[model samples]
Each structure stands twice: as C-alpha cells, then as structure tokens.
Target: MEVRLFRRDETDLLQLSIDTLWAKNHVLSRDKQLLNYMFYDNPVSQEIFGEENYGFLGTWLDGRPIGLMGLMAFDLNVKGMKKFGFAPTNWIVPPEYRHTGAGLLLMREMFKWNPSVVLNLGITSNVARMYTGMGGYHVLPDVPRWIGLLQKRKTAEMLLNGDVKFLRFYQEITAVYNQTTYHVERRFDPERWNACYWATFAKRSIGFARGASFINWRYFQHPSFTYQLFTCMDDKGNYQGLMVLRIESILGGQAKIGRLVEFMANDQDSAICLANKVVEIGNENELLFIDFYCFSSISSWGLESVGFKRVLKSESDKLVVPTRFQPIDLETTHMMAALYVSKDVQKKISLIDDQAWYITKGDADQDRPN
Candidate 1:
C-alpha cells in the first residue's frame, strides 16, 4: 500500500470509493460514505496543520485492495517538550483481518517512518490493549471533557436578558484598565506583547494592544489553525472582552469542541449571554461538542450555568513571547482554557490540534519535534 499527502488541486478523496479496511472502525459504523469525505472532511482542520495527511496502509494483493489502515500526527507545540510525540490518531481494521497481524504490520511501518513520534490513542474498548501490545503506552484515562449544550430556550433567554454585540472582521478590544479580573486573574501584559495586536483589541499601540494583535494572529488567522472569534460589548457600546475558539474532538461518534484559547470578559451576565449564543450557533451548524475555558478571566458564570463541565484543568507554566520584540515593562503571566464537543457525528473526525501544527523542522528542528 502507498501513503501519500493530498495537496490541493490533487484528487479529492471524498468520492464513492468503497473501503473494506474502514468498515469495522467506529467512525464507519455511522458514515457509509467515509472514503469519499475523509479527504475533504478536515480542510478547515488541515489548513491549520500542513495537509492533514493519511497513513493509507492498504495491501494490494493481485492488484486488488485487501487490507487498509490510517493514522495522523498531533503536531502541537509544548515549549520545552519539542519531541513530545504524536497521537496515534485514528485506526481501522476489518474484523476478519483482526487476527491476521495486518494491524501490527501497518503500525510498525508508521513508527519506522518516524521514530520520534510517540502515539496517543483514545482509551476506548480493546483498542488501548491493541496499542499496548504493539509497544504503545497508554496515556492515563483523560478526563471526559464536556461542552455545554445550549438548548433553544437557554439561548433565547440569554439573547433576551443578556446583551449581544456584533463584530465585523478586524474589530479591536482595548482593555480599559491594567487590572486583572476576579476569576481569570491574568497578570500585567507580557513584555512587548500587549493587547492591541488583535486588530479589534486596540486602535492605537497602547497598554495591551500589541498582545491582542499577537493573539489574533496566533489563534484566528494563524497558518496552522482554524478558530472562531467572538467579541462582547456592554449596552452602552463599550468594548468588553474577546474570545477565540477552535474545534476539537475527544470521542469516536462525537466531538469534544470548545473554547481552547481566549482572554477574560468584563461582566458576568453578558458573558453568559454570549456563551449561550455561541453554543446555539454551533448547534445550528451541527457542532454540539461545545465548551468554554477552565477559568473565567472573562465570563465565568455563563459557562457554569449552561452545563459547561470542568473535566480537566491546567495552568500555563511558561510564557513564550514573540521573536524580535522588546520586553515590556509590566509583569508577564499566561492562562489557558478548554471545552468539549456536545453532539454530531456525520463526518470524519478532525483531530483538533492537527491544524495548529506549524512549528517547522528546518533550522527550528532542534527546538521541538513531533
């Protein structure tokens, strides 16, 4: 079998081609047209990573497809841990071929191709045992992340009582003061990285403006990730807070998507309103795995009231500022949050961080590897 990357303008993989290898995987149990959609399913996801390539390990016996398999690399950056590893993203093998060792053959080939790649498989059913038998370590049962499902009634209640503001492309959110909020407790802006970096965060280069711009590029328009941007304003048209959210999946027939990146909000009621509104919007588009950050530096109450579950919690340990920028005068502190997918399984799952894999291996290879 051959493993190839799909460049744009190449053949679209989502067609009527049938598959014997994928027929037994959990994903195929729900998707009959997976072979066709697999290629096109994660463009929004791949655009963030390099190509969202596949490990199409299929056996060509007598020139006919007999066995098939696939896997993806989780290429996110973790600062000091450059060679951290790759998640053994997805796998499929027909039940009839389960005892044939075809799975072992495909796995050895994948690892031999990249010795540095450590595998992270979802702890589901007997798959974990299969991976362990192949010399793969089981990453302890990760918390079951949960995203709040905002029903129509909850959304309507928020829209009626909570204030909603619309923001066009390049909107700015300038922090009115330098003080940190209650729940998030973000420290002063980092050296050189201020809030204005995000176009909407600041009009003039001041206080936290540069940091905001950095956030916009680092999250929304970054070359290796797809994210949804949100802004909140008070009834008087004053800038309040902004959030950046990306898609993530934590289960087989479902997705655990939530707000993995963001800054804090200015008020409680408005934040809850916007959170509900975003969940409702996500559902309208068939994305149910919805969640907010772990801390509410911006809007804490809304996420809690809407069934947002805090299954996992982590604190930022390091703050890596931009290159070529001078250090700022204020103290530096960083924070992070994550949410989960609520519903939907009609398409191929996109490994959320696969899109955020942009750290190059050229001269920067010494800094990190995955």
Candidate 2:
C-alpha cells in the first residue's frame, strides 16, 4: 500500500476523487443536491477552493488505487488571511476504513502542510471520540438548529415606502468611509478574495483575532458559488451590519434553493430593520428555503419575529471533521457522539475507506462504526 501527497498536475486522479466524494459511497445518499449547489452553480468558490486547498492522499491496495483523501486547509482563504489556518473542512473517505487509522493519517498529512492556527469547527461526538484517541482537543461546541421562518410576512410600511430618510440611509453606506469600523461596510469586490474574507471575519468572529485573508477571498469569490452582500445603514446613514448569501439551484423549483451565507447584526433596531429587508428580498426572489445562522438570541429574536424558526431546537454548531491530534486515553469527547462524523460534506469527494485513512496495522476495513 502507498500513501502520497496530492499533486495538482494529477487531474484524472483528482477528478476521480472529487466524483467519488460526490456520490457512490457517501454517508448520506441524498447529498447530491448540496454538492450540485456547491460545485455547479457556485463557480466563484469552486475556482477558489477546488484544486488549491486540498492535500490529496492516495492509498494503493493490491497495487491498484482504491482509496483517496483531500486534506483541506479550510481556513487559508484570501491572500492576507492565510496567516491563521485550521484543519476544519474535510472531504470524502470510504466507509470501511474510518475505524482504521487512515483518517488520522490523512489528517496528519493535512497538518504537515498547513501547521497554522487551531481548528475549532464542530464534529459529531462519535468522530470526536476517535479524534480524541488521535490527539485533538476540545475547543468550542456549537449546535445548529434547523430554523424555519414564515414565507409570508408583514413588514413595516415605513421601510417598504423607502421615504427620504431611508434614501439617505442607503446613500450613507458608501459615504461613511472609516476603514476601522466602517471597513466592514466596504463592498466586497468579487475580484478581491482578501477583502471579502476579512469582511466576513469582522462580522463573524469578533474575538477569534486572526483569520486568512486569502482564504476568505476564496470562500465567496471563487467560481463555485455566487455571493451577495447585504449591508446595513442606519436612519442616520451610519453603517450597521452585513449579510452574505450563497444560492444553489434545486429541482423542486420553489425558487430553487437559497441560503444565508452569514448574517450579523450590530444592534437590535438595526438588526430588525436589516432582517425585514432580507425577508422581503427572499419573498421577492421566490426562494424555496432560506436558512440563517445567529450567534446571539437577541439577534435571533429579530429573525424570529420576522417568521424564521429555529432549526436544531438547541445551540447549533458549525461542525468539523475528526482532528489529527486528538489524544486517545483522555477520552474527553461529546459522550453522545464521541465518534460521530457528519455525513453532510462527505459527498464532495470519493475516497476508499481503508486508503482514505491508513492505519499502521493493515487490517481488513469491512467493519465501520457510524
């Protein structure tokens, strides 16, 4: 068996890995829509993250390539933001090999290349336990709730009318030019991945200091998905909040499919005002499903009042895969899902279970846990 680094020059192997991740042996068979949304319509992101961030590893069994893994530096986005990187996003792996140690090997290879900041993305408890066995530490846990907002809402006529005051507010977004606070207000240039990713950090992780500017650029500006930024303006014309969106076309035809990339609210009234407009836009666009993530209950209230319902019924988390460095005996893990791994993003790559993650002990990979 052989395990090696991913070379971009190997287009056939890469495409084969990508296609396998997209289907065939995925955790959830219904993830094709999500993949189509991510790879097909969202060209900007596909171009930015596709071939670049992956640290591909191929494992050969019986002298034939049977397994593969793509180690993604999920945090190394824009050029400026590359400084703070993490091993959050994970691709596909064959089911048979997850219990083995190939998952750890793939992750170790990912760390060998990135070796930047800590990875804090969420993961299922089962996978987390395996990760603990592998040497990962507990950072933060988030639980994502599937939220639903009323499709039909009654908005304030004052905003719908867009009186003189509202017009001034709209004009103020571009007028106020304080690169410090208002820097968040700067329109994200599609050509500039740094600006877009940094802008995302400002609104998303206020305290988690460092982020990859280049990584951010690739998140929204790449060729895979289209990004739409909705900036907020106070009645006084001051900049308030920013919302990023990624839409995927679905076959159901209820406005296809729509997603709220990220939404941040500076204050209550400002949040209420901003949310009102977003729902209006969603209604106009005929969006089938609009999902939003809120950090605080206060901010969520505005979205809730506007008819959006909570998703998971609990604190929803942005989950990640099992880390490479989890400590085995410590066993500090989410008891409910100590070894859990989400079937969500796995549809994006194809990796033979054993080969995707290799173990020192060459054991048959027919047995898998979750």
Candidate 3:
C-alpha cells in the first residue's frame, strides 16, 4: 500500500474514489442526492480550507485508491494569537481492505503535517475507539439539543413513558422570549465573510477564525444547498446574535427538518431570542422538528427554557434518550475528540474547558447538504 497527499489535479480522481467507495462499500452507502452534493456538486473545499490542507488518500499496490481521509483548515485563536489547525473528516476505508491497516496509515500521514491541533467533531463508535487507541482524546462530545414542533407522536410517546413533566409556569418561560426586543433580518451577501463579521465572534475566549471568504465558500457558494443566515439586533441596532439555518425536505418533501446550523450569541437573553426566532421560522414553514447541537451550558439552559429538550445517545442504542440537563463531559464526548501536537496549543486546551470553545455543526462538514 502507498499513502500520499492529494494533488490539486486529482479532484476528479477524488470524486471517483468517493463515489465508487460509497456505492460499493457494505458498511455505508448513500443515495445519489447525497453523493452528488458531497463530491460532485460542491467543489468548494479547496477555496475554503486552502488547497494545501484538504487531506490525503491511500492506494493499493496497483495505485488504486482504497482509503481516504479529508482535513479542513481552521485559523484558530490560540490564547489571543492566530494559529492554524485542522479538522479531520470523511475517514473511510473499504471493508475488503480493512485488515491491511490503510486507515491507520492515512492517519499517520495526516499527523505528519503537524497541525497545531487535530479536531474530529463527528466520530462514530468504531472510529472513536480507533482514535483513542491512536492517542487521541475525546475532547468534546456532541449532545444535540432538539425542540419538536409537529412531532406529536414522538412527544406523546415520551410523555406516556414518563419522560416529561408539564411545567406549571409555562407563561414565565414564554415571557423571556418577549422581553428581549430584537429585530431579526435575513441576509444574502456574498461578500459577508469580512474581517468585521469575524471580529464580532472573536470576542469569545476561543473559536474558529471565521471570515467572509470562509463563510461564502462554505455556505453561500455551496452548489447543492441553501443556508439562511439570520442576525438579531438590539434596540440600538447592535449585533446580539446570529443563526444559520437550513430546512431539509425529508420523506420526499412531505415533511421538513429545521436545523440550527450555527449559533452565536452575546448573552443568555440573546440566545433565548435566537431560539424563539428559530421556532417561529420553523413553525411558519411547518417543520417536523427543530434540532441543534451545542456544548455551552448557558445556551443549553436558555434553549431548554423555551420548548427545547436535551437528548443524549443511549449506551445500548444510538437512539436518543431524554437525558437530564447538565453540562456534558467534554473529555468523554466522542464527537469532540482532539489531538494536539504543540505544547503551546496543549496549554491553551487545558486553560479552557471544551464548553469555552465556540463550536457548532457548521464548524465541520456535518451540516452540509451531504
């Protein structure tokens, strides 16, 4: 087997590898709609993450691609200094060649590039174990928060199973939504990924260095998906929060799923207002449910107060359980795995807990159309 970095000229080869693997691989297979969106329609990876950082491929003795792993570049704020890191994604190996250790070989090559940090925000059970065995720590677990709108069956089932309690002062919670006088506006500026916009978010202790160029390439310029960006403002017109949303038509367009792609707020009040706006928009469009993944306790509390519920994966089944509300274990959450090679980056990681770092589905390729 041979391992190598993907050349810029091999995009078509990359696409062919992905399509051929997904179509023939037994462990996972996707429909053409997803396949097309993932590899064919969207060619923005190079422009968004930089051509040098996209990732690598493993080939058989005959030079046929048998394994693949992709990485997205991130300009990170490391203790107030700008640094670069990578988010590893789409790690795949065909079943027939699993025992040959092609996946591990690809991973070893990935670390050779020596990014400040290696972030894998979405890891399956098998991959999580593999990463742990490779000296990676599950730094952040993905606990997806949800608010059901038209999912009457699921909600009633939860209630009958003694999983929910009807609150007495529901009006008080609803009042929070009204207290913050916010004006929400939808925007579609291709040039929106500017330094000013990123500066607003950089106020946080740590986060992705999101700028206009990155945003346009990742969301607005995507070929097969449409993302709606909504900004909330106070009475004086100062920015309070922003929400990126995408409505996915499921069940052949008979129903839709409202996904809170990316959310950032200045305070609990802003978060509450943002949550309410999401619900309003979802309800207006008759969505089946509204769902999001967050690691912030304050944001979680604000969301729960306004119709949302926290759901964690069951140990025995991947199906969601109505877990008690609490701050999730950052180090054990498989979805939040991290491996830092630099001492400087490791110190920053220890300084702040996982929740202190800003993240959302939008950080990775997870929320994309694929």
Candidate 4:
C-alpha cells in the first residue's frame, strides 16, 4: 500500500471516493458539499492558507484508492503570530480496506508533512485510538454539549420521573435576559471581523487565526445549511461582539434544534448579551432546545446565566445522551481531536488547560455545509 496526498487536479479521485462511500451507505452523502467547500472554493484557503496546492491524504493499494482523508489548512494564532495547521476531516475507508491498515498509512503520511498543529474536530472513537497510539499527540478533553430547555417544567418533570422517550419540549417558557447594557440585532455581515476581533485574538494564548475569509467560508458561503449572524451593540451602537446560530430539524422535522455555533466577545457581559440573544431567538421560534459548545469559562458562565445547562461526558464515550428526560442522538457528539503540538509551538503557547485557548464547532469542519 502506498499513501499519497491528492494533487490539485486529482479532484476526480476524491469525488470517486465520495461516490463510493455514499453508495455503500447513504449517511456519507452529507459530507460531499463540505469536502468540496474545503478543497476547491474556500476563499480564505485560496488566499492565505495555500489550500490549492495542498492535496488531501489518500492511500492506494495496487494503484486503487482504498482509503482517503480530507485535510484542510488554516492559519493558527500562536502568541499573535501566524502559523499553519492541518485539520483532518471525513476519514473514509470501506469495509474491505478497514483491516488493511490503509487509514493508518495515510495518517502517517499526513504527520510527515509537519504542521504546527493537527486539528481533528470530528474524531470517532476508533480514529481517536489510532491517532493517540501514534504518539507525540495529545487528546483534548471532550467538549461538553450544553442544552438550554426553552420550557423546563415538562422536561424537568420527565427527567425526574424517568420518562425520556420524546423530543418535544414545552414552548411557554419566557427567556431570561441579563444583558441590560447591550442590545442585539440580526445581521448578514460575514466580514465583520474588525480590529476588536484581532485584538481579542491577540490576547488569546492559543487558537486558530480567525479572519473574514475564514468566517465567510465556514458559515456564510455554505451551500445547504442556513446560519444566522447576530451582532451585539452598545448604547452608542458600536459592535461589541458577534455570534452565529443555526437551527436543525430532526426526528422527521418533529423537533427543531438550535445551536450557538460561534461567539466572540470583548467581555463576559458581551458574551452574555450574545448568548441571551440566541435564547430569545430560540424562544421566538419555539425551539425544543438551544445549545453551545466551547471550553471557555467566561462563555460557559454567561450561557449558564441565561438558562443553558452545562452537560458533560467522558472522553471515551461515543454517544452523548445530553438529557435523560428526552435522550436523542440527534445532536452530533463532537469529541476533542488528537493534537500534535510541536515543542516549538508549545514554547510559544500553553496547552495545559483547554480553557487557555478559544475553540468552537466552527474551529474545525464540524459546522460546515453538511
């Protein structure tokens, strides 16, 4: 078996694997648009990250594509300096190639490329084992999925009585808001990252280098998913923070799920304002629940103040059963990916505490087109 990265002109090979994976199991079809967005059309990638020249990982057996992995490049922020990292996504290996070690071969080739860091946001249990077992990489703690019940009475009662088989929640609960100083309004500005945004990044010890091009590619230009952007403004009408929200229908459209995909703020108060805005939006739509994923202590505190409950899970768990009252696998359980922080990169930033860095589902390919 020989492992090689897909050349820029070899998109046909990538599309072929996508077709094969989808034909074998329909669930893989959702990954097609996301893969395309990452490889071909992302403006940030084209302009800064040099994604056009970087080929995805593919393992060949006798000149036949047996396994593939989507690798996306991003400019990571370390001590305010720009560095590059590759996020491994959409790992595909058919059953016939699973035991042949094709996936591992491709991964080894990926590490040989020597990125400043390797971000694997959507890691499966099996893949997690494979990555960590290879050494020189550390696995982040599982990112807890928090849920805020729009109407807690019925759901709370169901939890206490052990009757968790439904996905519907009562819709009469009033949203509580603590952000009295600032107000929020819905906006369509994808290039809203300003000096304030870069200043926020400058203060961070570690995180991805966020900019307009990256934001537009990740959320605004997605082909199928519709995401809403909310801007927080002070009394003087200055932009204080930004938040991105998305709602998904599940259980055959019987349930509406809301997610706070990304949020960046100047302070705890601004974060609370953005979080409260999403809560109010969810209430207006009568959503069953609204959720957010992050490791930031400030954001977590603000979100909890607005009725969102912090849910935790073991790093080893495959499925996240957020609420016992109505357990549904509808929400994707995003495990922390394996990271390879080189000694040079580690010297510039601290990875000791996960909270030291800023992260969201938007960091990796988690909230992409699919």
Could you tell which candidate, 1 or 3, scores higher by TM-score? 3
lDDT of each: 0.35, 0.39, 0.58, 0.65
Ranking by lDDT: 4, 3, 2, 1
TM-score of each: 0.40, 0.52, 0.74, 0.81
Candidate 4 stretches greater than 4 Å from native: 21-33, 47-55, 92-105, 153-181, 188-192, 235-237, 313-336, 351-354, 368-370
Q: How many clashing residue pairs, candidate 4?
A: 0
For model 1, where is the 10-residue window of minimal lDDT? 361-370
Best by lDDT: 4
Model 4: lDDT of residue 287: 75
Clashing pairs in 3: 140-336, 141-333, 193-212, 194-212
lDDT tens string, model 3, 14-53?
6677667644542113343443333323344444434553
Clashes of each: 46, 76, 4, 0
List, residue by residue over 178-216, the lDDT tens digit for candidate 2.
Answer: 223232343543333334335543433311222233224
C-alpha lDDT of candidate 3 relative to the true structure: 0.58
